[model samples]
Target: MTPREQIGKQAEREYILHGKRGVTPKNLAHKMGVKLSALSQLFPTREDLILEVYRINVQEMNREREEALDRALVDSGGKPLSIESIMDARILPLARRCIEPHKGVQYQVGLSRFFTESSSIKNRILHEQFADLTQRFIDEIERALPYLPREEIRRRFQMTMAAMLGVCGILDMAAYGKEPARSEQEMWKMVHDLRDFLCEGFSAPVQDRHSPSSIHLNDGGRQWQVPLKDIACINADGDYSRVYYASGGCDMVRQTMKAWESIL
Candidate 1:
């Protein structure tokens, strides 16, 4: 490798091993058997070196994730990808890569510190780098969802990201605060549930009921007929009851449980 590439790899290793606390160009130079002046001439400043290492590390992670997604596409035999497959291809590989024992914790704590540093230049560059990656992820989502309008695709993408980040933020804060190490199984389950929610939110609306049922119910002073299987549960609210159905809507009745049962 070239001297600059060598410097970057060495610096990244040192940063990963020692984290943000003990990493310095002087120490790195000493470890590399080079004078501090030579390292400074190559990297210009300590911040420059740190930024390069950080960028390279993040890029490598993204590269692996993209490869995993590509493999999934190849295995699908050219069929339109399901939303669940898309979500798994996007998230599960990264989770597996990062969830290895101490490595995961080190990466989490180290990167969090790197981005949230008060140093203006470092913070700005890290923000830009991450924002670009996030936009690329959204673009991929849009491409996968050919049935959605452009605006709808963008909206879903934003909500998907928000949900994932919000959940992750909660876990990170708890773990960093030394509450406990959250179970990876639980985290994956939460992500799977989020995937289901995103699929429901983004995909086409279900077909409206056309067939009338023998079971009749009163809603808003008008009688409506729905199948018994469509009724999920009855929610009692004070003097009234709300009947939740499986067809993505609910109906409110002006009668109590006893009254409704008598009619049945």
Candidate 2:
């Protein structure tokens, strides 16, 4: 590889090991067995190096996803694309990457920097790459479910992506957190459950916003009503419960699980 490419690879490794806040030019230089001045000469700013690493990683991920999609298509022998096939090609690989050691940490690190970084350049780079990947997946999904409107497909795709990312985040925390380590089988089960949940969500008809069943909620001083069917799930937390909506909104309400169950 060229010197610039080598620097980018080394920087990515540093980012994975130390996370966004932990990585620095000086430490990266030390790890690379080079002087700070040499590294500075190659990358004038730390952000530049970070952006390069992000670009390389995004390109590599896209390439892998494309190859997986191709293999799935070939394996089907010209049969109609199923949601399971598309998911196998798309989601499972990402879950594996998130669970794998060292290598998968690259994804976690990239996602962290993507959200936490404030630089306009960084945001543009991340957003453009993410949008491109999302569009490609949506196009493939359209082929699988042609009957659904493009807007509805996009909405379901966004929700599925959010759930998949949340699973990855949780896995990352479990791997590095104080809790006991989860078995590989358990991790895979979580991923499969997420895939099943997403497939069901994609197949389900869109909920009507004008449904008569509504739940009254109070957020501090503000009171509002939410459609009952819009609720995706509820989690009990002591005396209060957290409500998750299918539209991706969440709220904490002063109600118990039994109260919610009895009301429903």
Candidate of highest TM-score: 2
Q: Please, what are the lDDT tens digits per residue for candidate 1 over residues 171-247? A: 43344666665676666665677678767776765332343344677766798777778888787777788888888
TM per candidate comes to: 0.56, 0.70
Cα TM-score of candidate 2: 0.70
Q: Any runs in candidate 1 off by more than 4 Å, and if so which?
A: 1-10, 13-24, 30-33, 117-140, 169-180, 197-264
Deviation in Å, model 2, residue 75 alpha carbon: 3.2
Writing each residue's lDDT as its tens digit, candidate 2 over 72-174 gives 7788785557887777667876787777766665676666656667678666785867676667678878888887888889888888888888787676455
In model 1, what is the error at residue 7, expressed in angstroms? 4.2
Output the lDDT of residue 64, model 2: 79
lDDT of 2 at 240: 83
Worst 10-residue lDDT window, candidate 2: 203-212
